[model samples]
Target: MKKKNKSKWLVPVLGLALLAPTVLPTSASATPAKKVTSVEFVGMPAPATAQDMARVYSGASVKVTYDDGTIKSFPLTYKTLFKSTDVINGTPAGVAVDVHGKPIMDRSVPDKPVPFVSDDPDSNSLMKIDGAKPTGLGGNPLSLITHYEYITSDQSGKSAYGIIPASMSLSTIDQNKATGELSVTDVKKVDFSSVGGLWIPCNGSLTPWNTHLSSEEYDADARAYEADPAQTYVSSFTKNYYQDDKKVGNPYAYGYIPEVTVHADHRATVVKHYSMGRFSHELGRVAPDRRTVFFGDDGSNTMMFLYVADKAEDLSAGTLYAAKWIQTSDENGGTANLKWIKLGHATDNEVKAYIDKGIKFSDIFEAADHDTPGFTKIKTYPSGKLEWLKVKPGMEKAAAFLESRRYGAIMGATAEFNKMEGVAVNSKDKKLYVAMSYVEKSMEKDIKGTDASDDIQVKKIKAGVTYEISLEGHQQDKDNNKINSEFVPSLMKGLIVGEDLPKADEKGNTAVVDKVANPDNLSYSESMRTLFIGEDSGMHANNFVWAYNVDTKKLSRILSLPAGAEATGLQSVDHYNGFSYIMSNLQHPGDEMIIPEPLKTEVEGYINQNFDNKRSGLVGYISGLPSLEIKKWKNTNKPDVTLQVAAKANGAKVTWNNKEHTVTVEKGVNKMVLKVGERFVEINGETFELPSEIRVKKGRTTLPADLLDSFFR
Candidate 1:
């Protein structure tokens, strides 16, 4: 990996460059230093004894109090479940062959985690395992269940579907399940070569029928032109995938949800659901009734959508609808009334027929002006303009089904939902939880407007918030054709929003880390009544997985990842071998080293070279550097006391004296002075001792950064 020299400063510390002065007799000094009784040094505050340091450091148990005054404690442990490299080696031989008939090389995995555990209703009956104490297909009293891993790809050359069967086994199953441990085992990958090349496969739902419903996120508009060379209405964002004469097949063949069913024989079959409508699908959440499904779009300024199937078990035929937001109030956290606007209805065959004809998917909706009989104008909401497509005569009604987002916008659906992510349903309260990684002010518009002009200016700081929409008292239309219920949506919870938290430096930037921000994938466990939230956030240095209690509105940190890593596919699983599991993916960790020994020299050099004069900034701020510590100067003779920095801001201040070649640390009226190149310090003119002499390297001063915490206390 190539290294980039991004930052100029090395690290934060306090140091001074001093020149040697002519020697003077002890009694001949001009001004005599006054001696005082005692001296106190100002230093950083220490963490209270009550703080749970162990919980944050190791996989120890911690209790979190919710906003509603409810309490729940659990031991936090994050196991690597599986890595991308593991899946490559785990694939059965002769299963996947490349374009040249050679075995496909190992590929990287993306962020989709779908489980097929023994306790899952669909997998239980299919695998002939008792749901109560289910075992794996291998029958070793299965501790870990089967799960599917979806790999998103920008390259068309790699395989997108890989499965890890029985990745982890539970060591024990008991009432204290959270305390139970899991032992990982070698698992093989089940390849889905029949699905063809999948592009940007994202999050999806575990279907009511016990199958995996994975989504295809990005679609190339250029694919539409390839299907119909005469097409004129293609979106400008489409990429020309066939430019290099790559025979990678049709682009229109991708972008829909591929339902995969893994049989007891360990073979899998994938079927793309054209009827579910194609867009940048984030994921789908199936309703308990099985007919209605909620889907989130993972693009900027996108729409929230749903599909109603003709049958409870099948998704091959359905009517798609987009949410229309009706602002009830102007407050940021106020409730908004939601109504669903019908886009269109079509079966998989009918949609395929339109694609077979000369009808490009983009031709279904009016992207720009100048076309006759363009999209029909629909009722407008404050969010944006709404219109429905005017399907050309003799054209199959599948245009709306293929370009679902465009059709939904034309039908008066609100497209202001910024990055609509994971969707989960609360079976007990009949509420749907929608995770919007970014909630913009524009989504709160109350008046109708045209799609041509922009009304709401995007804000600089965007925080992740979860909305709770009540689905109570839903009633069908008189014709029994559509549901005519108003969805009242209120801000259920907000992450990383407050005055104390740092804001993003620029609009849409993700540099600042608040308490919690950018909540992504969500999974709700009915039995535990807890919602597991995984983060795909750039705002935080280390992304974390959180557990929130729906009833009590309490949230707690369950797991965290290293730098540049994201917590993906967080889900609450059923008890197995006496343990309940929360499965998640730690994606793409950064190069930051976690161990101390190898980094000791590098860290010490950084502190000596880069300790800036500015004191109030993040650099040299004790709280900012969580891993800072003090150590003995290399090859130092004297040894006694050392300074340590604390976490609080009101710590001690150290001053460097250039003329006298000395260092002084002060806390209010008290002071301690240490001469340059000496191991002893004078406390209020009284001799004091130190563990080592003040060291200097490369013309810069050095000291143990953390040892200052002791004097302040």
Candidate 2:
């Protein structure tokens, strides 16, 4: 006789699990969490000593609130797959390679970290591919991680201000069957020399079709560069990428969206989408519909952009539009009704033809410093530069995607968004979240349509705000054409706001540490009902990764990085082998902060101690989290969301593919498999009659209330 499973159903949507078995070892006391109520993170003390300032630590304790209001705490430690200093083959991870595949050296540092080990590693685009990659533990499910070096800084710590081409690497990461941890078997640099290398590759997102959508931030001012090539900072790109300074670089070739496709053999291929308008692209978050995309442009005087592909799961061709914010209220960070203004439409090949044919910015628009008769007076958001220009007639497609910021202004879209960094969406809630790093300059209270780009005028919050955009279906573009997408941003309001202190606190902090400060990267977990925020702050003494539960409105500071580092590579995956991962990375551990003298010096020493002379960044995840992948299911005389939650809590791995789901749960050495939408299941290799037929609804696998007891028992 066995005990019965009193729980109902379990739904493990396509969530992603993470890291290698050795990312970090769990203690002997560590056990798989059975039931999760609410996850609460433990915080660390503010840094005062050299040891405190440079320490990278995590309490990783989870206090989950249960259904009946019972609370239990457990340990969830932090683990690292690899640091930027880790080497594979003969080169360091994320080093920019040449056309001939040699490491690019930075002439700035004495013991150059450029070729030795990139100092500013950013984005961690982890995704699984088809087939298995051969590993020492045998063939494991193949996974590819498209990670990159944002921009290499010197020993003095000048980031994007310095000369260096951003680089990306493809690492072969797969789970170890024996230990149930991820293993990093190989690392190869994805060469972008064929497309002007990479330009400040900062942040990225994964496409709906399981591809990597990376970005080129800080879009170079091509007009100024073309006018005076010798003065532009991108000269290093030509010298490093092509190994020739005289190779004459084209500024237009570096800013478009680059999509990477991972292979079964652990290799990656990249293709730049010219149709998706580019201007300091932070994250190109695709909607669940797969075609609609919202971009976060990072800089002062930026614009909100949207693109709808001609077909689902395809970004090669699309129609570009910019947002016009019609303010609804001036509360919190302000609420507004968004109006889409049609910029233009084009395909990837159409825009690339102009780049290959040597089309200049002057060819796209004839400009003047003053208002002229035929010129349209428009101000570009990212640069805050006013220009009088009109499309040169034939280069409409080129101007639409290449100089998207300027063209957006010409179409009467709102350009007042400042420091818009990361974008995330929740399909279930029909919501989109965008991070504004600083709520000043463009977003400060101002008169509408003055310079045109400064339209968004809300009370300044400086510390920052995360906006929630409402999504609606059956929308039309500015030109009154059907947008053909279900996810269109209709209204936006601030969901989370950071508090700004009047003066420096006792810890010399300008912003409240208990709340978010300059929130940069955001990843939303639907099942957990949590919004994960990472800081890229100049106001806080130390940066933190926070988990803010949307339901309970509880803010928990989960992990703290070195004093001056900003958090990066934050992504939330729902289904991966019936497990979930909250991916995050640390960058520029020893950056120069604007704090007072003695404290700053103390913090610098701490960074040196923890980071060592390598001054390298790390890539890892917060581990041992409870399996909260279950969703509600309706059947067996009730509607329940805890079906999959119950199954996972009972140590089961549920997977969905082609309307078929298999639940694999183990008790001792006996492996049991339950196939939903079927009458019978298997125990290892032997057939067994189910007490009742398991079912599925709306593509979700559900457990029948009566059948669950027999199976678990």
Candidate 3:
């Protein structure tokens, strides 16, 4: 990585007020939110008392007793957010409530904890509302607050763990956008025991039956720790279908299970589904028909995969498939076709074969004192209705079979396949999008001859290009946003404009049309499928959110993201207004800095560097800096993310600092026109000075770090 050095300054934490807060709303709102169907208490931090943390967490349900005498149950899940001495106890319990007041029950051990159990006085988890916040309304009703963690395994035996948590907020976020702040508390820790296991951030899809289809993303070497039934750290979460009637503890009604470790001895909350292929998955989404599920493997050499649950509802027993893009080059403008390849049979025998080949069973057998031997027998899988694929007649059956055979080779998949990350469906559009990273393509170019005299020589020309896929109307919602549109092929034609496409100068006087879509006028097939490609590495290494147009058999809009940003997950929800949430790890261009290792030293240095004024505004113009510009910056573009900011001044002087980037607009007098060679910026009329040199890059420009220097000074 080329280290870019620039000035970095820290702003007062108070500046965080500039960002909007994220509040999850309840189903009663204009947009009905996804109801909280269930809740489970995972490993809780050691509580101060010996009482099982699960008991307090699972049983608690808060009720708001409004002044009107109307009572509403608040969804709450008590869990250890962080094991910190900050609280008197090692296990500090924080309540995570689904603001939407979705019901919760234990799926694994069902037939016990029933709804309305909140009314029971014996429950430790019920929240009794004594009074509302003082707005002069003593008995007025208020909303409940909860928290949850986005966690994953280290996969590397190194023990380091990453945990991302959203800031605590009342569920009514839309209403609180003005005063509420959407912040993410992040912590990366390294410890012991849980080391080396693959971390699973299972972004499960909503099944037709309203259950989640959660899949596992395991590390390849996870089996090294196991002796027999070689486990590679894959876990599954299935709906156990059991409803707990007793007000005892957990009311999941359905529970998630870690089946890969063969730790079956440890009673699992749920069973594993071997039918879904094992890999490092970020998220998975099922097709409308609910028969086909598309998933992406995270990390290098990731490949797009699909699992055709023989029985859509019964994903436990089904054949898995991988998508293979048919590479082609012809006058019809080189085409890419997705071919489905079967991974394994739905039978338990096939699953056992994977185990025999070093997949561990002990990972699922929690009771095993030590690792055991590999077991290979279809007998291990429970007999159940297995889902199968329904292939169309006159289709490329041979090609599909051939592709399946090739993908079935796990070893080959590791060696030959590239990483395919981020699979999403635009529910409204009925299109699916998959993202690939660091993909290279050749761009034809013509060079002049070396002869100085006369003849212009043509040089052999080929340039490598990396791009994302944009499939029109493939991943659409039930209502149909793009797929159902009357403007079909023609609208799709102009979707993806090449990078070199001509654009007039800043003046917009000239027409620059370099290249057009490789294959224009693409029409969707009956099965409008799509994929999104997110590149993690390479030169011009950008994380692109590309969509594939299955109908036209070509890529459509190629959303080029800032360098180093990865679009890891996607969710198109009608619940959160009309917005498609794109979860990304894009480094924010502002709010960054470099401090010395020693806490005292870095602080002293930072203070001295700005002469006691640590703000960026104090520093004078640093020259030779490259300006960062974002042509398409939008708050809705990135949902559920913490923004970082970076910048540069004149003369290409650069600073790669990390500052809290705010999306909230600042209060200002008015807007004005830009003069020739003039830069635009906001300043506190009372305390700030104009930066000596500020240049705005066309489209989107990186806010200068000196803005802080100029103000703080």
Highest TM-score model number: 2
Candidate 3: worst-modelled 10 consecutive residues by lDDT? 117-126
Worst 10 residues of 2 by lDDT: 20-29
List candidate 3 segments past 4 Å from native: 1-215, 221-271, 298-304, 323-325, 330-334, 347-407, 410-415, 426-430, 440-570, 576-713
lDDT of 1: 0.45
Per-residue CA lDDT of candidate 2, range 57-132, in tens?
A: 6665666554545443445556777777788766577676677778766566676555635656777777767674
1-713: candidate 1 lDDT, tens digit per residue: 53432321111111010111111112211122222211111121211121221111123243433232323222333443323333323432112233222233333334532222111000111111133232232222222223222322223223232221111111111111111223333333334344443344567667767776767665544333555633421221112212223333444555677676655444445677888887777777788878788887876657777788888879888877766666554343334666666776778777766655645545554333333355554322211233444655543355567666655665556666667788888877787887777665444443455442232233323556666777644544223354633332222323323111354332222444334467778887775466767666766545566657666666655564543345555555443322334556543343222223333234323322321110000000001100011112222332323332332354667666789677777665344556667654443222323455676555455543323323343
Top candidate (lDDT): 2
Candidates ranked by TM-score: 2, 1, 3
Residues 1-713 of candidate 3: C-alpha lDDT, one tens digit per residue:
53323332211111111212122112121111112221111111212221221011222222222232322232222122122111112211221112122222212234554221010000000011233232222222222122111221122212111111111212111212222112213211111112111133333443444433343333333223233212321111111111222312111111121221111121112244544655555455566656666665544333455555565456665555554444443211123444434444454334534444442323222222232333111100011111112222332222122223212322122212223344445554655544332121111111332111111111111111222233333433212322322111111111232332143332111212122211101111122233323233222222233334433434422233222222222222111111112222121111111111343243334333422121111100001100011011112222221112221221122222224221222222211111213222222111111222233345333333323222222
Better of 1 and 3 by TM-score: 1
Clashes of each: 25, 21, 152
TM-score for all models, in order of appearance: 0.58, 0.82, 0.35
**Candidate 1 segments exceeding 4 Å error:** 1-74, 87-193, 222-248, 356-359, 362-390, 394-396, 441-461, 476-481, 484-514, 591-713
